[model samples]
Target: MADTITLEVARYRPDRETEPTVEAFEVPLRRDWAVLDGLNHVKDNLDGSLSYRWSCRMGICGSCGMTVNGEPRLTCATFLVDYAPGPVRVEPLANFPVIRDLVVDIGDFMRKLPEVSPWIVRGEGTSVEEGEYLQTPEQLADYSQFSMCINCMLCYSACPVYGLDPEFVGPAAIALAQRYNLDSRDEGADVRMDLLIHPEGIWGCTFVGECTRACPKGVDPAGAIQRYKLTAALQSLKSFVLPRGPR
Candidate 1:
């Protein structure tokens, strides 16, 4: 096994340069060391000026996501030993505006999140004495897969739809909407239906399915969109067949 590996990390200092550049740093190619571990070594020992986002290092935080070898991945979960024998390229997630180096501005995602009404909604809340809303295991399984989303935005990074149209609301937000929509305890699906059924919503998805391929948590945004599309079509059929009352 090689003792060392070269990491070509992307650097972007808006004040320093108009475009991003790569700076290489040789780091120990330890079997236990992840790509993120190499970056930390560079920051702590070689270059203190290096900038990136990381927390929990266990892949739960999802803040350490970056494009490694042109594929979006959790840097902390991708071991350096996997890309042995030479240099590895790491860059900011594609599609989103770069904030600094490996950190891309998530403001776009943040802004679009509320549009889906991600939280559980109800017409009325149960009293404190009534306890929290309860669900059977069967009901829990309905949306459980979507609930695994860590909001990593790797889906957005992998989405060609979002890259073509920034207004498309992206994958994570839509999957989260399904998270609450499928929840039996939540009654907000009606409120979200109009926004989701819009042209800029699920229709924007071309079903490339790269979003699902890129998701670290295994959340299937592409499947959610397809399900929602079927739902909308059924709704349209019902409305056409059964007219409104007293109209």
Candidate 2:
């Protein structure tokens, strides 16, 4: 086995350059090491100036997301052997402003998450008691899948819509909205729908599905977004048949 691995990493020094560029590093590595571990090795031994973000290397924290060889993935979950035989390319996630090497500004992504109001909205007294709000197994199953999102923002990085126009709500936020909409207790879906399924909402998704592919948690954000669209369309059609408001 080779004693060292050569990595072609994208480097950006905001104070020094207007654009990012590629630089190579040769460092010793083990076959059992994850990419995140290798990055630590680079930062520790080969270059102290390398920049990246990471936490909870076990993959639950949703940090350490970056584009490895042009594919967005959690560095904590990606292994070096997966791209063996020599040099690997590491870069920051796409579609966001690069703050530095392997680090992108995610403020817009976070703001979008808040725009969807990603939470349950029950009355104050509902959960004030010690017992939990009643939920059946089926009800839990309905939204439980979508609620697993770790907020890695890899989906946004993989989305072409966001790359083309950052105004688009992107995938994760819409999926989170649907997660609450599917909830048996939440009443905030309507309040959030106008922000979703609008021109800049789910419709903006060309369905390239790269966002779904990039998700590390199997959240299936594309499917969730599509479900939101269908539900919104059906509700719009039903409004015609419903009785008029109380006179």
Candidate 3:
């Protein structure tokens, strides 16, 4: 293995540069060092002006997500050894506005996350005195896989639908909505139906399946979307067969 590896990091300073540029830096290619570590080395030793967002190197925070070799990945978990003996391209995630250098604006996702109401919503409140809403093992299994989302936004970065239409709610948000909708304790499935059933919501997804492939947490957002689509179809059919209010 080479002692050092080259990292071509994308840089964009709106105040200084009109276009984004790539700068190369060499760092020790240790087996233990990840792409984030290399970026830290550059910031610490090479360039102090480099800007990016990262927190909790343990991969729990999910803030270190970036495009490495044209794929969305968590830089904290992606090691340099995997792409050794050459330059690795580290760019800001796709389908988002660049805030500075390696940082991209996630405001779009932030706004859409709440639209689906990815929480257990009930009209009647159960007070603490009423006791916690408990779930059996079978009930917990309903949405456990979808519950693994760390909000990495890699799924968004890889989604072509979102790349084309900015209004698309993307994958993680929809999957999370499904999570709550599947929960036996939640009564707000109807509340989330409108937004998710809209053209730019779950319907926007073409099921390219890249979102699922890009998911590091193994959450099948694509499958979740398909399931939700089927669910919507069934509900629509049932409503048509059995009209509401009075016959």
Candidate 4:
């Protein structure tokens, strides 16, 4: 195994340069050390001007996401030894405005996430004293897979539709909407559907499937979008056939 590996990290200082540039640094290539560790080493030992965002080195914070060799990954989980014997490229996530080195502005995602209302919504006249909304294990399993999203934004980095159309609601938000929609206790599916059924919502997804492949948590946003499309289609059919009266 190589004793050291070179990291070609992207650098962007808006005050000084109009475009981002690459800067290389060499760090120890340890099997236990991740890409985040290498970047930390560069910041601590090599240069102090370098900057990035990271918290909970265990990958829970999802703040350490970056483009590693043209692939979006959580640097905290990407082992440096995996790219041994040569240089590894590290850059800020794609399709987002760069804030600095290895950090991109996620304001767009933050704004869109709340539009879907990822939280559970109770029906009108429901009281908290009505006892906890209990659920069976089977019921919990329905949305549990989609609930694993940590808002990493890696799926956004991989999605082409979002790159082309900034107005698209993107992948994570849609999956999160599904997370709530599938929950048995939630009564806000119709409310969320108003936003999700639009052209910028479920229909925005081209089913390129990159979002699913890029998800670190196995949350299949593509499947969720497809499922929502079918649901929307059926709902449209029902509204046309069943008339305005209650069924």
lDDT of 4 by residue, 138-230 (tens): 999999999999999999999999999999999999999999999999989888988988899989888999999999999999999999899
Instruction: Please identify model 2 stretches exceeding 4 Å from their true place.
Output: 240-247
What is the lDDT, from 0 to 100, of the residue 128 in candidate 1? 98
Highest lDDT against the true fold, candidate? 3
Q: Clash number for every model?
A: 0, 0, 0, 0
Which 10 successive residues of model 1 have the least lDDT summed? 238-247
Q: Model 2: which residue pairs collide?
A: none
Computed on alpha carbons, the lDDT of every model, listed in order, comes to 0.92, 0.88, 0.94, 0.92
Candidate 3 residue-wise lDDT, 1-247, digit = tens: 8899999999999999998999999999999999999999999999999998899998889899999999999999999999988699999999999999999999999999999998889989878998999999999999999999999999999999999999998899999999999999999988898788899888888899999999999999999999999998888788889889321
lDDT of 1 by residue, 1-247 (tens): 9899999999999989999999999999999999999999999999998999999999898899999999999999999999998699999999999989898999999998999999999999889998988899999999999999988899999999899999898899999999999999998987888798888898888899999999988899999988988987788678778878321
**Off by more than 4 A, model 4:** 125-128
Give lDDT tens digits, candidate 2, residues 67-178: 9999998999998887876688999999999999988899998888989989886655454557877899999999998999999999998999899999999999998998
TM-score of each: 0.96, 0.94, 0.97, 0.97
Please give the lDDT score at residue 143 for candidate 2.
92
Error of 2 at 177 (Å): 0.8
